[model samples]
Target: MSAAETAAETAAETATRRTPGLVPVGETLRSAERGPRQPAADPGTPPARMPWSFWRLLGSELGLTFRRPRNLLMLAALGVVPIVIGVALRVVAAEDGMGGIIEDVAGNSLMLTFVSFSFLVLLFMPVVVSVVAGDSIAGEAGAGTLRYLLAAPSGRTRLLAVKYVNAVVFAYAVTAAVALPALATGLVLFPAGDVTLLSGTTISMGDGLLRIVIAVGYVGAGMAALAAVALAMSTFTEVSIGAIAATIVLIIVCQVLRAIPELGSITPYLLPTRFTNFDAVLRSPIDTAAMGEGLLAFGAYILLFGSIAWARFSGKDITS
Candidate 1:
């Protein structure tokens, strides 16, 4: 073969050798234009889902609620009140020699706990619970963080659920803040022994503590119901204070109505009226029927208010 022909043949051979590994310029341009290739999904595989961690969101919410200075201060005030009540009773008993219900409470630590609950649950507990629940959504909205929260993977319904659950948990915590301190203060200040029920029957100290536990649980349920009302109010406004004030006003109005003889028929349905049903636990046999009625009322309030809150919040325009 000629030299030129041999050179041409060698070049051809080299080009042929490289062709398998080399992409055509047109194919390269097209591939570049097409961008990255995604792997084909298998028919059996589930579709990709947004990562939503409900528990984590709840935990974070609880942490924020508990850590707030205002909330902590309120809890401190609740814890302190029981101590003040026990001390005041002890002082009164020492000076004036007490009478009637005061005499009973002065002589017994268990009775003192019940008395403290009686005084606090009427106003203090509902106030604190109202503040927390009323602030849940409205506070977020007022601060402009609510829209950002909604922007995340957390759905509105899930967010609302978390807010309500957090409020309920805080309600229980508020109840404990009262009961535990009252019990501790009572044990420190008064005599601990058998407890005399309102029915004139006596129970062991252990049984008395159990009764106190039941009372605390019942009171906590009542507070949770109140929280639901406050949460519903929260959904209607961006101002947290407005919601809080509205709930407190509603509570006061209900209490005023309950005091009127003319409203006797409606008193049975009032939420504040149910707050005192923990007294049923003071009876020897334990007034389960009355307590059951109170619990049913609480459940009804929770359901009604919860639905209202959900309805309002789901459609609320988050401009903040």
Candidate 2:
């Protein structure tokens, strides 16, 4: 071999001897220069997480709710109220004869709605909201299903938001349940004509029907606030019945306090106080002020109690 070739061979042999089984310097440099070869992703490793959809959760909850016999019975009961009222009123009008305010309202289907709503807003609506709200979280916990729910991919806050939304939807459903039956019974039993406003101005039947819808919506909004309050109470206890009873008691206390002449100032702030204010829909000019105050009060209540519920629920340890 030539002297230069022999020298190159000797250097290569020395390098191979010095670093036996070692990678070449060039290969090592190339490896170091390149980005890290991420350890092959473990096939067993879980995929990245995504939040569960609130609508999907709500829809599931609604499915469970409507499937319950108690819920169906409650709806049936609300539906019966208008039928009973219509039959009783018809009997009274036929026997004793319509007179005074009764004579004025006898043939007015809209008036029947007003009368039914007056009674319903005072008791039935609140009771329905209370029952559903009390069942929202407490019922699940009571039935030991809360643990399974918490095991879902959704976070506590998202779960709570879904529950609150469910309660609101339920309140609206209950309100509609009451209003629709009353409207139907009124149309069947009485005459649909110009509605006499509380201000004594007459509005077209179409306008009156629109106002009735607005009135139903207002009641639903008010019931939604009550649902928030009941929901907050529900979170603190696992017993659904206890939660429901407590909510009813609280409502009764508020109503009693509101009735006292001495507490007139604070009565305006009471939850039940604004429920009946939907009557303002019957006013000629449509007393927007009364409705605005009622809606504002309901909003405030929702904010206050909904915050309490979130705080309580987020920290709650679900053993069930």
Candidate 3:
């Protein structure tokens, strides 16, 4: 073979080796004609989060909250407690000569509501609200669903807002649970009439019913306060029980402290400690001025705690 042919073969081999995984120059040029593919996006920007879509989010929470045994137990207790109280009042009044069966029957509506809700606000309502609200986020996290929720198309802010609303709504629902049945039973057992006011005035049955409904509204406000506190504590705990326990303990302690008599003037400011006084509703005229103040204070506490909880929830890792 001639030196010229040999040199030409060597050059060809070198050129091929230099272009690893190379196609023909013509093919390479043709491929380059197609522009870069969408810049090979990095894991996508992650579509904006839309956490709260009202009915949608509430439906999700309702399904989960009802699954809770604690909530079921609360419902049972809500029913049972009032009936027991009614029977007790029936017996006690008989012995004390407060009234006969007819009078008792007439008074049952307002009386039973007063008794049942008093029991709830003093303990059961707070516990129920805390358990449900507190567990909302933290429980989801514990169950390993928090991360999935965070990653969902819903925005984090909206998501947390929905959760917060769910907590408040659940609080109202659970709190009202005892009220409805108790009132119904009382009305069946006792005769109802215009509420007797503190000032020796009487409100017709219609007016009394309206006042009672108004009281329910105020109590709902109280429940919202409890829900806010529970939701805040919930952010601190992965176990819903932890949030529940903390709220219960705090409430009990505050209540005990407020009952000290000497704490009288300032006690009502303790938010959940001295708020609901049923007398305000049954009296001659609605006298909610005091409770209104307490409600304002409770509102402040709820807002403060709720803000912190939301901020924390927004920043949490949400691994689960």
Q: What is the C-alpha lDDT of each candidate?
A: 0.88, 0.82, 0.70
Root-mean-square deviation of candidate 2: 15.2
Deviation (Å) of 297 in candidate 3: 2.0
Across residues 1-320, which tens digit of lDDT does each residue of candidate 3 receive? 99999999999988767443323423333333432345554676773233335568768777777777877787677777878777677666565446543343445466577667766787877777777777877887788776566544455566667788887777667757777777777886666775555466777878767766877777878878878888888888778788888988988988888879987887856766644754577665556776667678778988898898877765554444
Query: Per-residue CA lDDT of candidate 1, range 1-320, in tens?
Result: 99999999999988777543333434333443443466998999996443346788999999999999999999999999989988888888886756877788876799877888889998989999999999999999888887667755567777899999999999999999999999999899889999888898888999999999999899999999999999999999999999999999999999999889998999999999999999998897999999999999999999999999998777665667
TM-score of candidate 2 versus the correct structure, residues matched by position: 0.82
Residue 50 in model 3: shift from native, Å?
6.1
Task: List the candidate 1 regions with Cα displacement exceeding 4 Å.
Answer: 1-52
Off by over 4 Å in 2: 1-52, 95-97
Reference-based TM-score of each model:
0.84, 0.82, 0.77
Residue pairs with backbone atoms closer than 3 Å in model 1 (clashes) = none
Ranking by lDDT: 1, 2, 3
**Candidate 2 or 1, higher TM-score:** 1
What is the C-alpha lDDT profile of model 2 across 184-296, one tens digit per residue?
88888888899888788999999999999999899999999999999999999989988899989989999899889999999999999999999999898989999999999
Off by over 4 Å in 3: 1-54, 67-69, 99-108, 262-266
Q: Rank by TM-score, highest first.
A: 1, 2, 3
